[model samples]
Target chain A: MSGAAAFWRKYGVLFKSDWAIMMAYRSETLIWMVGAFVQPLVSLAVWVSLSGEGSIAGYTASDYVLYFTAVLVVDRLTRAWDVYELDRDIREGTFSAKLLRPFHPIHWSINGNIVYKTFFAMLMIPSWLLLAMFFPAMRIPVDMGTIGLVILAIALSSAIRFVIGYQFGLLAFWSNRATAMYALYEGIHMFLSGRIAPLSMFPDWVADAARVLPFYFTVAFPVDLLTGRLADEPETVWIGFAGQAGWLLLLALSLRFIWRNGLKRYGAAGG
Target chain B: MIHVEGLTKIYRVHVRQPGFVASLRSLFHREYREVAAVDGINFDIPEGQIVGFLGPNGAGKTTTMKLLTGLLHPTSGRIEVGGFVPFRQQNAFKKRVSLVMGQKSQLIWDIPASETFLIHKEIYEIPAASFKERIDYFTEMLDLSLIIDKPVRQLSLGERMKCELVAALLHRPDIVFLDEPTIGLDVNMQEALRRFIQSYNRDYKATILLTSHYMADVSALCERVLVINDGKLIYDGAISKLIDRFSPMKRITLVLGAKIDTSVVEAAVRNGGGRVVAYDYPQLEVEGPREEVTGLSAKLLTELPVIDLTIEDPSLESVIGLAYSEGAAGESRR
Candidate 1:
């Protein structure tokens, strides 16, 4: 088989298997999905209550809802949990089984990310559409060309996050602090990636830091695109995509380096 | 085929000493020592052979298996499996080998064993007919037809092990490394697995390297064995030769027709170049060199009031124990 054809064949089976497992714990999955809404909804509510009839940073109460709504969908679609999964697998020695397979182990993590995101997307989009029917704030203006760009940005953002998370997971070969370290990074990312608040609401210095670093591109840029906030600024949209692309490339190379070196240090620690 | 030359794996491990003070000190500064898990071991296995890797726990049986399977990079020395350096882990090399560790499971716990089989099929790129053929063959051979669809978490230990074997062998790998494959199994299950392994080896001509604490597993399936202890190969050859090299005695048990003096029996056994294993009013047991069993037994029967007598070869456990003790002795000497 050709390379792409072989990849699809393997990915298809992996996706199918992961889908079954996801379905098996669907109640727990639904709970996690519902629980995720609390943060974005809470932030939206706080901002709305504070705005009242005014804006904190040239914004209205409804705009806060729209921004948080966009944040919800984009974060869900682009989020990855590979860091936790990889940490546990490596720490517990299940990773050795994965490494022994004829396929590269990274493909398994990729397939898992695809499966979960696909699951989240299937649920979140319809819910978003339903919410839009009732709440004008949730509605996004239909624009085919701009929607396509948002998708491309979200896909790139997901790739960046996945690579970063996986590299953090690879640190388990040396120390048990991999997950804790990633958690620290994630705490920073929560603020800078615009999950907790839009970058525009932050102070100028923090806003610039979020933009210049990889954090803004991971979630906030995709949210901005989805909310049509960047449609007028074509140059900024391109820069956002460029930021995502550059970070993804660098992180992927680093992941390759980490994976190669990590295998040498793999103790295969358990029976 | 597998080739290992002076293959050594040294692990630098944190010395986690006992007590709160040690733990506190370790937080700031930890001591470490490099221990050779596989100390310059050398061996070669031909294709289509079943070879037993014998060793006590922490003696490097599992470490060598991991090194051969490319799960760990050896600290030093060389290893080649199927004309490829195992640590390089080429896809072609991985495709040709399978490892089954009794303590670690590869099957997904939440899903049916059949699901894992399907996943393995795709990863291995096995053709449909070949995949189906092997699955059916392994299922029938392992008696997994009924349990294959059950979630692995729901299966008994033996059933799960059978499913694990099926998951590992569905691709028909040319080299199989089995580490304690029959561990935690009942006698009947162990027998079944041993038979399945023997049949698999015979039919596919796959090179098998296996380790088990059960001596029967070695004696029944493996014609040759490599005895390793203290990270070194002390004996490598046929099982019988291992017995002769280490345990040179044949156990002889004799029933006494009446009570006998303990000193007299001890002297007689000593005279035959044997040690009195146990002595009671009604029975006498001793072990001596195999060649002396006949002469010694005859003399016992003629001199004492012997009711009945029987002789048996030393158990493989005793032979392997001696091999390990000798290795420890050599380690201490060095």
Candidate 2:
């Protein structure tokens, strides 16, 4: 078979397998999805109370609701749990099974990301529309062209986050603290990725710092795009896409480097 | 089908002492050491041959297997399995080789074992017709018809192992590396898996390299054995030759109808260049060279009323025990 044909065949089967696994854990999946809402809602509640009848950093109470809602959706859609899975698999030695396969291990994780993201989108998008019918704050008034760019940004954001998480997990070859280390990274990401609040709500220095790092591009850029905050700023929109693309390329390269060197250090531990 | 020369894998490991003080000390000044997991080893395996790898824990059998299957990269050495460098781990190379570690599972948890089989079929690019035919044959041979749809997490260890074998062999790989395949299985299950592996080898002519803690597995499935210890290959030959080299003595058992003087039996055994290992009334057990077993039996038959006489070679377990000792000895000398 041609290379692309072979890859498509394998990815299709892997995707089907991952979807079945997700279905088997549908209840837990729902619980996780619901659980992820807590942080964003809490941030929204805080921002709304602080705004009351006024506005803070140009974000009124209704704007806070929409912004956090966008955060919730964008965060869930782009989130990657590969660090946890890869860390456990590598530490427990089940990773050797993945390494021995003809298919790359990263594709399995990527397939899983695709499966879970599609599953979440299927549930989230219609719910957002349904909620928007009664609550004006849940509505997005962007054009279809802007919606296309939002999607491109979300996918690029997801790819960047997935590669970063995967590389963190591959650190298991060198240390047993891979999960803990990724947790630290995730904690920083929680604040700087703008999941807790809009980048504008933070101080100028903090917002600039988030932009300087890869943090803002992963979550805030898509969140901003989805909430229509970038509707009037086409140049900023393109810059966000460019940032996401640049980081995605860099992280993907880092993944190849880490994988090539890591296997040399792999003990294949207990397996 | 497989070749190796100076194949070595060295691991850099953290060294720590046991204590809160040591723990605190290690935080700032950590120590590291190098361990040669698979030190300079050499061997060749022909296709269609089932070879057993005998080694104690930390003996590097699994490391060597991992190197051959491309799951690991050797620190230094040359290895070619089926004409491809295993460490390169090319797609074509991976498709022709399979490694099954008893302690590690590749099956997707929370899903049926058959799901993994389908994924394996695609990853290996097996034709649809052959895929169905292979699964049907394997499931029937393994008696997995009833539980194939059950979640792998819910399956018993033996049942999971049976399904794992099906997943590993679905591609009909040219080389199969089995690391302790029957580690946690019941006697009957182990026997069943051994039979399945033997049949698979016979049908596909796949080169099988297997390691097991159970000597029964080796004795039943492998005619040739490689004994390794401390990361070095100490002995490589037929299992029978190994037994002959390490344990030249054969065990002889005699049951006499009448009680005889213990001194007489002891002296007769000694004169026959053998030692009486045990003596209890009408039953006496002695171990001697293969040549003297018959002569010793003759003297016993004529000197006393012999009711039974049997001669048997030493068990493979004992032979391996001796082999490991020599290997450890060789390590110390180096």
Candidate 3:
């Protein structure tokens, strides 16, 4: 088989294995889901209260609910914890086993993340449905064109975030405290990705700065796609896709560069 | 096959001292020292042979294993395993070899050992039918059926080690590198692992390189041994040769039916050209003068009340200790 074909085959098996492993710890998985969902739910509640009696920054109370709910789903779907896992693996010499494998270790991690998100999103859908039942405003348009764009944006966002996180994880091969650096990266990501609020709600300068970076493209841009924020201008929708593509390419290059350098250092340390 | 020529690995270690002042000083001016972990070792092994890598702690056995498996790169020299440069980490080369460390584990902690086995099957891309056959064979050989389904965290160290061996060999690699594969196991478990490794080598004709502090592991499984000390090869030859060369004396322990004066026995053995090595109540141990052990034994039988007696050659541990002390003394002299 070709390398790509073998990769996909191995990835498929890894995904299934992670799924089974996750299933065995269903309660812990559910607790983690609840913890993640609570963040967006709390944001929605706070935003709704702040928007009482009038729209704030052109977003009504119901729009805030929909936006933050979409934020939860998008965040959950694109989540990548490979940095933490890699840090643990590197420190404990478990990475030696991974290095022995025939395929790149990142492929296994990506498969693990994808499988985990798929199962997590399944559990999340019912909560979304129940919330939609009580709040009609949370419903999005069923237009096929916008829905297709949302799917594309989501796929790119997942790939970009995964590669970016993987690149950070590879740093563990060189440094002892990779998780600390990862935490700092995530702290920057929170504000730049508009996790707390829409970019428009931020100061004009802040929002403009975030636009040029890739963080907003990872989370907010896809959320905007689902909320019909790109409906008025089809060209801007393509621009969002372009941003996703550019960031994906950049992060892929960064991941490759860091992995090579880190492997060199790892060889030295182990030798 | 494996070839290592002038294989060397150097480590740059940062030196630090305790105290706030020292820590502050270190931040501005760090001290670095170059430690040679493996210094220019050369060896070659043909296919399907089991070679014991014997070394004391920090003698670079594990480092060499890591380098051979592509987990590490040598500071200098070249190494080839299974006809490929190990440090290059070629996919085909990796697929043909496996490394197992007894102190570390690869099995997922929260899951059954079967989960790890399945994952390995997928990672190695074994055919489903072949994977099942291998799993069946390993399970039977390792006696893993009873514990394979239980969570790995719940298994005893010995059981986990058996499972670990099963996991390592399921891919059916042509070369296997094992580092202390029986470090913490009891005697029975250690023997079982030794037997499993021997059978695996015999059945598959796989080349094996094993490093263990346990001399029994080498004595039981390996015919040839490589003894290293202070990052240098001190001895490399047959296991029996190592024992015979380092240890020139044999031990004989005798039990007396009656309480005999220990001094009289010691005097007799000393007079007979044998050295009295140790003496306990009702028992006498003697070493040296192998040529006269028979005469000494006969004389003791006729002159003293003898109950039972046994003779033993020097053990591998004693041989290794002798080698290390000799190496230390040689270094001090230089």
DockQ of each: 0.68, 0.65, 0.50
- Ordering by DockQ: 1, 2, 3
Error of 1 at B117 (Å): 1.3
Worst 10-residue lDDT window, candidate 1 chain A: A137-146
Q: How does the DockQ of candidate 1 come out?
A: 0.68
Candidate 2 chain B, which ten residues in sequence have the lowest lDDT sum? Answer: B325-334
TM-score of each: 0.90, 0.89, 0.90
Give the range of the ten consecutive residues with the poorest summed lDDT in model 1 chain B.
B325-334
With a 3 Å backbone cut-off (N, CA, C), the pairs that clash in candidate 1 are none
- The most accurate candidate by lDDT is 1
Q: Which residue pairs collide, candidate 2?
A: none
Residue-level lDDT tens digits of model 3 in A45-156 = 8989999989999899988988988899999888788888888787677888778878777777878888888887787777787878888988885587787888888888
Candidate 2 residue lDDT tens string, B1-334? 9988899889888898999999999999999999998889888898899999987787889889988988788989999999999878798998899999898888877899999998988888898999999989998999999889999999999999999999999998979999999998999999999999999999999999999988689989999888887798877878776776678889988888988888888888888788999999778899998767788778767776889988877665567678776653454222
Stretches of candidate 1 above 4 Å error? B248-318, B327-334
lDDT of 3 by residue, B1-334 (tens): 9999999988887798999999999889999999898898888889999999987778888889998998887899999998999878888998899999988887888888988887887778888999999888888888888999999999999999999888888889989999999988999999989999999999999999999877788989999888877777777778886766567777888888888787788777777668877778777887865566778777767776889988776665677778777663344221
lDDT of 3 at B331: 42
User: Cα deviation in Å at residue A212, candidate 2?
Assistant: 3.1
